[model samples]
Target: MADRETPGDAARSDRRPLDGIVVLDITRVVAGPFCAMLLADLGASVIKVEHPDDPDYARGFPPMVGGGDAGESAFFTQFNRNKRGISVNLKSPDGKELLKQLVRKADVLVENFRPGTMDKLGLGYDELRRCNPRLVYTAISGFGRTGPNSSRPAFDNTGQAVGGLWSMNGYADRPPVRVGTIIGDLAASLYATIGTLAALRTAEKTGEGQVVDVSQQDSILTLTENAVVRYTTRGEVASPLGNDHPFVRPYGQFPCKDGYVFFGGYTDKFWRLTCEMFGEPEVADDPEIDTMDKRFDPDVAERRVKPLLERWFSAYGKAELEAMAGDRVPLSAIKTIPEVVEDPHVAARNMIVEVPVGGETVRMVGSPIKLSMTGEIPLGAAPAPGQHTRSVLAELLGLDDEAIRRLAGSGAI
Candidate 1:
């Protein structure tokens, strides 16, 4: 794999899809911040707002680089890059007014607070839409805004369980498991981003903005399609398959000499190819497993097909098998992080990126979206608390030094 910079100058250097857009990010932790981060990556001028006394709780997350508040949490840096930082004490009257002014000017506002928190602050969508008719107001929460459980506090794991992912994600004999990554939060963030963008476009055309209510549970539920359909349509409640797919046999991971490879040679055509590759051509023509439906049957797969595949798979190492399979077989050796970093495909596509944090360069995952015209600009560092506070207030609200000093003295900023 070749390592290189993100492409930005190949097309129009001055043009970006969201170049003139302004995003106000009043969010904390994973889901909401990640949604704003994606917009910032697309060239929106995003202002990340935090409370003056208590900053984003994620800043204190682990793997701290020990530069005080400037570059403290690597975790926070991963999600909050490419944003301007400002602090405002929302509980204060002056701070509330300042945020209202920002709302009037922003094209989009994203928040992940509990359902009624903003309403209690008098900064809810109802009040804010009065000031800016074209504001795209988006809220990401554990439950929906109007649901019975909307006011209850929830986290990623809560969303997973409530959304039905946790119940069907593990082996039948063991306790249910959450997915390896924070898929609950990640899924919600993706939906929130899509909803916000859709609303922003409609606002531009109609001269009206609408509320985008994205619930973590609702987002995750969409991903549970297969399981939900099985129960509702067939009266069959699907449990965990333990590396096996619901119907496909010989289609999951198998151990090799060095590591494992996921093989999808389940259909009749691919099954014949797999048998030929395994030097067992006779097995491919066997009457019991000749058809795709017969091979897909659970009992037949366990009784006959699995033993033959496992026996063949154990003789080859990952790289040797990959070299022999070429592109004909639907197979891949799972890559470790080191292997992924050095991979030619990843490097050629610039899938691993470096952004500066303090004096050091930190590597993070790159954006997956690759538009011909929208190759990314270089990523910016996450900010210290209120790093652009005075400048942003002055620039956006026309506040001079005396006014900023008074607000600061009053603990409003």
Candidate 2:
């Protein structure tokens, strides 16, 4: 073990929302790992358990700068920050015993394996819950824990397609489209985190732990805003309306001088204001276009307003239009990725953070959750494979040097 620290180290410890909490993260890929990262960011002592045969598959993805080995993928680094890594082959008896020992001291356990994978490894919730009665077990799955599609494979696109999000995207005339971002995976992960925190709160109150079952399909299902309402109340099986709102017209993406601006006039007042801003006050008087119901017709609204909107928006640039719109009618041009990176407001808000790694600086998005009392701490770069294995085994499991060496030699860790 490293030399012991004094009282000053304890006094200067980072204090955040989840301080004093310990999380054992036995998840990989996106959803489960993201939840663990969020907990770690809030001051949880998160120990990421990986297999000795291979680390998380995400560590081998592309978009790497140095073109090094599989351990340097940016996708893995971005989501797995602020946590410690250790190697453990759960198939081994020693490894299972080690994990049980860690679980006795853990507050939460997160996993994202197939339904029966964990049980095969003997670390299923039923077995592990017995090891620690207060351990919060979070299981993130594909369709769900039990169902017809529960055993099927799933990815972000699969979830999006199954959840009705893709059917509602794109223009009404074109084919259904999937969102560019991995929203399905991200949403599931975020909901998993929320569920974990809720379970943690309940555990504290009741002095018992519970299982949090997160389904990617279920998470994606939650994103179908008005689609469900329209289907249930009006028998409206929604199709692609493109950038326009399904329930409101004149609320879609429109062409600007340089790029495109999204105009969202969801209400009658906003619709009127949109017409006024574009010097098309006659639209506000037309019985066919005045009311919210009439204005919601894409054909009617587009025909009556597109030309006037184009002429008005063409006269001024994006900045001028944005300034004139002034959040009254909700108008702003769609920006590219580079533009988003250089946006002044984004910089001002510290959304893009610069960090030093490999003796150079790399830019990435900062953590969105900002606490007033506990300021953001500087996190170091991702470690190499098995970088902290010896230290973690020594500190948490109280394994001596001989034991660690024996485990490493026998391929048990």
Candidate 3:
């Protein structure tokens, strides 16, 4: 805790890639916060704008710093790291003017409110572009800003169900299941981040800013990739095949003595190697099962090859199976979360980092992007609500103490 740099201190440093850029983050919860946090990690000065009376609801979410009702949420802290915070009641006239002032100096602005919410408040992209023509304005929502369902409220599950992900997940016999993680919201955030960066580049070059409209459904649909192509071209509907691959035999998870191990023997060479490793060389040599197409046949794979490999795998432990197959076969043991956190590779790559929170240290997932020139990005603590209201107003808006006091008295800070 003592060694970690504060967000303000980090923002003052010059070595970051987005060092001089200022981001006005008027978003709450996962999708929007995740996107802004990435920019912050890359060295942007991100200012999280919250309501004067009610801040981001995630601030009170579970897994708090202390084991009480009043503690700060670690979940919120993890996503909002490396950002300053300010509170402003946008419904108030003073607050609106304050935001407009901030917009004049900001390089980027991000929000995830449903379509028309910002427009009603006079803070939409069309309006803000007038303040700063070079501002990169991004909006993330469930269905995007120009669709029939643009105003429909959605969360992670809604995106998964509407985008066809739930239909293709889980076992064929079971009900459709949402993925374990909030991939819907997270994926939209990732796509929005990419769109924002690209828009920023264009804005910098042409001195013109544009709106980046990102939809959770659209982002999830893009991940369907080959499934959509296969359905449209072959008139085939994909169903959950458990861990099995649709086009290859012996390309799924196998139950070992202790746990499950994934083996992808998709290529002919790997198929033969897997057979040899499983002590079933005869299966590899048989003319009926030699080629990929023959081995991929449902009846052949299910009744003949699968049973033999299952029996062989059931006799060995996961580690023994991995060692036997070695690098020749694409074998992996399905590790749990704790195992992954303690893994040697993860440590070496710095994928787990410790940050200060509430006078203590908490570990969170680190950024994956590595830059040669910028080096390691600093991870800073998330700020308290309106923590920098006075300082930011003075520094950016050139407001004196009297002005700041007046704004605060009027409930507009």
Candidate 4:
């Protein structure tokens, strides 16, 4: 995949692997926008298509770049970076025909509408494939294209609740909490990106494109891990452990003098090292919990290991404890948002990037996918509504100024 070539590789204007590919992003909010942004970062020419009059609601998301309601959404700016923007009235006949025209030249089309909305507009995958046989049709939905719940409109929290993720998140006694982040949308977006690239590869190889259906609920269900397997294999309905692992002892977050530190001294070797680091080497030789298997017993863990670790951990600060543990025990300070943004390790990895927007700079998390050839992905400011409509229409569809003016007049651009 890293070496795959496309039409304009001879010029090598963009050294990224996805150069010469074009993507039509017919999506809003999180999941779909994130998928398209990944493609854009990889050097694909992504055109974000929103409704002309009522554009993506994310444009109003707050903490606006220039402050108040005067400027663009910083939230929108982060996800939509490195993409051109267009607006189309998909409800109109002219808009439908215009989208079809753009489809013929596009390598991929990504949409996050409800199951049948595209079909109602007559721009569904079945219809679009007729316009371009090699176009990858990527769809992200709540439950999926085929299911009893397929038609339901879902947001991030909805996906988490329905997919059983919310039930497993918090302490067993307390009401469950949704994952701190928008894992439902983000996980689905990651899966959609993987599916799109795979389908794109098949399109290039066999000259045939296919549908990529990613459901947020399905994505969440896939991440349930040991809970699902435990139920199936042992009929054990897992309950929340409140930062505790199912089998490992001394492996969860512990309070230090200031802030918290995650400590993993479960393995016998690491446990011994941790004991030595605390100047309690005799504790490591305790016959009652000498081996890792013995330490897993509830009685031993509850009465012995937990108290020992907690007593030691409470005496030192997070950074001091982590430094003492070093590479011997897997220990690290739990960082806050500000701490993470200023982290030396994150800076060294180029994980945080700044994008210039409307004379202001919005700092954003950078793409994690790094290729040796494409060392750094250039960030483009998030576009105003329909900002690139005329350019995209003229370049891709070969529409002249008169035609562009007519489309704009009809509110179909």
- Residue-pair clashes per prediction, in order, are 2, 2, 0, 1
Task: Tell me the tens digit of each residue's lDDT in model 3 across 96-128.
Answer: 989999999999999999999999998888888
Error of 1 at 269 (Å): 2.3
**Comparing candidate 1 with candidate 3, which one achieves the higher lDDT?**
3
What's the candidate order when arranged by decreasing lDDT?
A: 4, 3, 1, 2
lDDT top scorer = 4
Pairs of residues clashing in candidate 3: none
User: lDDT value for candidate 4?
Assistant: 0.90
C-alpha root-mean-square deviation, each candidate: 2.7, 6.3, 4.9, 4.3
* Candidate ordering by TM-score (highest first): 4, 1, 3, 2
Highest-scoring model, TM-score:
4
Off by over 4 Å in 2: 1-14, 69-71, 275-283, 286-288, 356-359
Q: What is the TM-score of each candidate against the true structure?
A: 0.95, 0.91, 0.93, 0.95
Which lDDT value does model 2 have at 307? 65
Please tell me which model should have the higher lDDT, number 1 or number 2: 1
lDDT of 1 by residue, 254-355 (tens): 888899888899888888988888788888889999989999899999889888877887898888888878878887887788988888889877888997
Per-model C-alpha lDDT, please? 0.87, 0.81, 0.88, 0.90
Candidate 2 at 82: error in angstroms?
A: 0.6
Name the better of 2 and 3 by lDDT.
3
Q: State the lDDT of candidate 2 residue by residue for 116-171, as single tens digits.
A: 88889888888998999998998888787888898888888988999998888877
